[model samples]
Target chain A: MNEPPRLGDLVFTPEEVQKRVKEVGRCISGDYVGKKPVLVVILRGAVYFAVDLTRELSIPFDIDFMSLSPFRPGLQRVEIEMDVDIPLAGKDVLIIEDIIDTGLTVNFLVRTLEKRFPRGIRVCSFLSCPARRIAEVHVHYFCFEIPDVYVVGYGLDFQGYFRNLTGVYTLYDPTGRSTQILKAMGKGGKR
Target chain B: MGDFSIITISREVESLGDEIALRLAKKLAFEIIDREGWVALLREWNTELPVEPPLEEKEQEEWMVTVRTFLREKAEKRGFILLGRGGQRILEGLDSAFHILVVAPIEIRIQRIAEKYNQDRATASRILAEQDMQRERFLMRNFGIDWKNPLYYNLVLNTSFYHIEEAYTLIIEAMRRATNKVPSVPVKQRSLFEEKNFLKERVFFSHPSEEDFARILDFYGIRWLYEPRTFPLVWDEEGNVVEAFAPDFYLPDFDLFIELTTQKQKLTWKKNKKVRRLKELYPDVKIKIIYARDYEHIVRKFGGRK
Candidate 1:
């Protein structure tokens, strides 16, 4: 059997990731000082980032998890596998995502949440992949802006692995295209 | 034809068409673009032409083009009611526009004119005749169309038979039904994965599962053709007979054929063998076999029952 590719050079170290998350958390705290925001973590990927980011917040907040599937039978819309238990009406909502690419899911989520009559809705993703964005969405807070490459670790995964790692890294690409991209970004050389 | 966007109101003088248009606009929260509104739009475009187009054919055609362009743009932006201005002829084939013509008996129209204008019966009859003649001549000269033709309108309302409120309500209901019906023709260049245009045709599925699968595909806005082609796998010695395989669905957007097998695992081997043979025969044709388990998993994920 062919061996699976190993992890490439680290894109963000544990220390660097924590520092950026803290900065973003502090910014959110400053902006929403008087109000308690509902932090909605998109499941199976954003769990780790949501936990770390929420821990850094100094204000009072409620946390909820949502799981969504892209397709639904007999309906041309995204299906919500799991909904938030808390009442979202008249509450400030902040969607926490591991990554934002294509922006279609975020846009759909925003529109879905808007029907709940929330005071306002915003997005906060750990990584923003603007190169892969096809839908227009405003990211209120993001920790890092990454290129369009196969990224893993820190709640992001490749084939359901490498998500438990504390820091983000690009997966080793057999075709070398990801390596070329990382090199262009001044990373993933020898280490 | 598409969404209920534009409404064109053509009415005989004092036929309650103006009242219907005004009330319908208010009820539907639509903008009523009457002669005043049209003049304002013309002024906004910096055109100093009269409210009516010139008698010359070329100038009138130019005016018609300008008016049509403005009407199309306005209709695309928002729902509005267009009053008069040869709207029926100007937007003859617009799928998003609904054309209405209002009429009443000559005696009723004369009575209305006399009542509304405080004129005598003879004067009212003379005024109605002159106005009707002027309108007929205007339409005939400008558009080369008979203004009173019922064929030009999707609906014709006689105010003598219905009150103003009843007239507008009926119009609103008709507009809704017209908009909901599938368009007889394609209106614009459709993008991939859009709502399928085969809504008007009744598709007969061999199995209920196939129908369910088609519904799921439609939910995702994936355009598909059912059993569009059959590939001959075996031919007779004389080349007159053959065995063939037809995939359940052909997704034109992806250029892929999907064969759905909802049978038990043991029974699916026959289909698998046929798919294998098809791949060997036509190496370039892309095909996928969605097994029963895979379909169940998809349904389960979406919280749907079998």
Candidate 2:
């Protein structure tokens, strides 16, 4: 039988996550006081982060969700599984993302929303991994800057599991070994 | 109907082709042909959804052929004024065709473009230069012919000095001189000239984030496509669907598939599994996963401004 995957060192405790979220929320509220900016969330993953972030925001803002898929090659279009229902014209928009990877997805989202003639656009993310970025995406609000390690729990998941974990933890091999140890083992075998 | 019926206008950027074409079509009582209408018709035949301006070279070439076929069929009927798209070169064999090249000095063209487009001089200049290059390259690539070659034209008018009315009068007078005579067809010369190739790379975005990505790529002159196809990773017990991954941007020039993970830790493992499978299955394919911090850095550098 296959062994269960082990959770590595705890990176962010539940108390730490709450502290960061409240701090980000306070910052956003202070900045957007009377603007009534719309919060547009990127769905399927950011849903949990969006809810937590929204609860912290004292400012009045509407929320919308959008999902996008890349277009097949040879085609010049992208597929929108779902689009924001709110009209964005002349409105300040705050895009709520769970994480920001290469910045392609958010960059793409920002450009599309610009066409709608929004007065302003900003991005807010729960966490970020800076090393793998290829496209530039402006993020106005964020909680933590984590390393480029696979994390799960508190809405971040590994293999569609572990979102229910209360704290953010690094994922490791099922054999209870850190990835670095496994790498060393493989290198030793070659030697 | 006289044998001479077609009047083709070959013009440089901001030389007033639209104004001249409209007036010429009105005077001759001929239908004003728009290539866009033909494209719409072609779209109806090809796909249910309205097609956008083609981004692929092959697709653009196909559209050009459609344009030629549409114009050729239209010219078979009565007198018509064909504007741009090397109509003069394409229909040069027709004895009834009178080709005119309208040209202005670069300064005059720049000024005209600035005023007409309500753009600043610098922007207008950039636009005019790009348009000029595209036209020149298009003609050279399609017909292996030079746009400025006087041999391809019957009359070359300097639009800088002449008013639109004066230009129109000159064309009418020239038409009268060749009214009853058939201009002998010049032997078709295939030009060996090769124009510089330009990429027709473009991507349409459904989300604002994707749109931002495209702008950055355009600013950097890097070509990208969004989620073009699905790469199947894992199969179910019955070989049914399990996990499939569609990367956000495929940078053809770099031969890399970039998947941006803005998702919290939840699905990264699944995504990694799929990416690993993809690499194992297609060993030559390169894939990269960009996390949130790097993307924020990029956004900080290039986003929010334009």
Candidate 3:
């Protein structure tokens, strides 16, 4: 068995996350003032951020969840593990994302939503690394712009662990923390 | 391949037909002939053909015919589970052949493509659309058949609603039934009876649980109307219906209605009251509520929610 990965440096404290979430919420509330927008939160990664952001918003809105697949061709096609139950046609939809890395998956999601003919669609990401983006995406709302690094915690995971952690941390030594976790779990290697 | 000879599985992108076919083949211990396998066979049959992809339009047409002919010959000798490569068209009239088409909505396919590539949904969707168009054209050029024509298939499965396991079992049952038919008689002799045309104006379910309910009805060979009729339980002062209940599924074969609710019991109290009134008003109607706890058990046992 492979060792579990570890976190390195604290990138965003829980307080920082809470603060940024409020700011984004305020901005969204102002932008879609009278409109009852559907907040489509990308699952797993953005779930924590989405919940906090929803609370910060004073305006009445509906909440929905979507889980997206990692992109690949052939056997691994882009798939939505879960879809929002609410009808999206002609509705204002705000996509909440945890992090925008390559901007590939997010771009795909936006296009997918567009086919449903929503009145308008905007993106709000908790974290983004513009330097590493391969696909072009315009994020309307963002919290922290961090450097390209392995980040985990607060719903982000290194091999499905550390998602329970309260704060965001970069894994400078990928092998270090993973090894320790694996040792504790009585295992070792990739994940 | 026990007794059933040839199985042709057609599918749209991201429908998970390939996975279901693989599992079915394994269960039956049949020789699987997927796209790559067909390509390999094509190479062995004639060294002149291009082994690499991106074949010219003319080459692709030629390849389809050659592969179809090859599969026909192979099926004549023994059984095989053929995946794609227009097997449905080629094996159409074969007595022992079973043709299945698996499909899901475009949105679901886009999501699957995105996940597989770990790429953006836009790129994944574009590729799927392109691939579908290519497949459509390929079939039209080669066999003059629409890829989605339900008439060409013995079974059309919506994998979006049916889990792989449920799908596999359905195929097994269908194949078993197919095998029991007289050897010389065509499987198409079986009455379609609300099969192909059933999808016209079909409702797109908002939840996987509802989809699963539909899948079960389909697996049992039952005809169902999705939220077809609304039953009014309360009326407004102006003689207008104030409250009504639309059950998730109405089974025509059994004359039964099914309501699937994953909502908490307390949350559904009002809805339950309306259903009770609906029952009282229409005493002939039979309704069943699949509550959250029972629904979870079904999901746990069947593995469809995944």
Score chain B of each candidate by TM-score: 0.55, 0.52, 0.52
**The TM-score obtained by chain A of candidate 3 when compared with the true chain A:** 0.86
Residue-level lDDT tens digits of model 2 in A9-29: 566778888889989999999
Ranking by TM-score: 1, 2, 3
| Chain A TM-scores of all predicted models | 0.92, 0.83, 0.86
Whole-structure CA lDDT of model 1:
0.75
What value does the lDDT take at residue B242 in candidate 3? 62
Q: What's the true lDDT of residue A154 in model 3?
A: 77
lDDT tens digits by residue: candidate 1, A1-191: 85755898678888889999999999999999999999999987899999989889999999999988645544654578899999999999999998886465676688679879899999999999886543458999999998866578898776566889999897776667677887888876654
Question: Which has the higher lDDT value, candidate number 2 or candidate number 3?
Answer: 3
| DockQ winner | 1
Tens digits of per-residue lDDT, candidate 3, B1-306, equal: 235678989898779988998898787767888878878877887778654322223444555556556667777676788887778765566666788999998778878888888867656755675566556545533443456878888789998789999999888887777675644755342122223234424568878888765554443234455665566566544334467687887554345677888898779997788788877866667777777755653433223111
Name the runs in model 3 displaced over 4 angstroms: A71-74, A174-191, B1-306
Better of 2 and 3 by TM-score: 2
Q: DockQ of candidate 1? A: 0.08
Runs in model 1 lying further than 4 Å from the true structure = A1-5, A70-77, B1-306
lDDT of 1 by residue, B131-150 (tens): 76556545544454446768
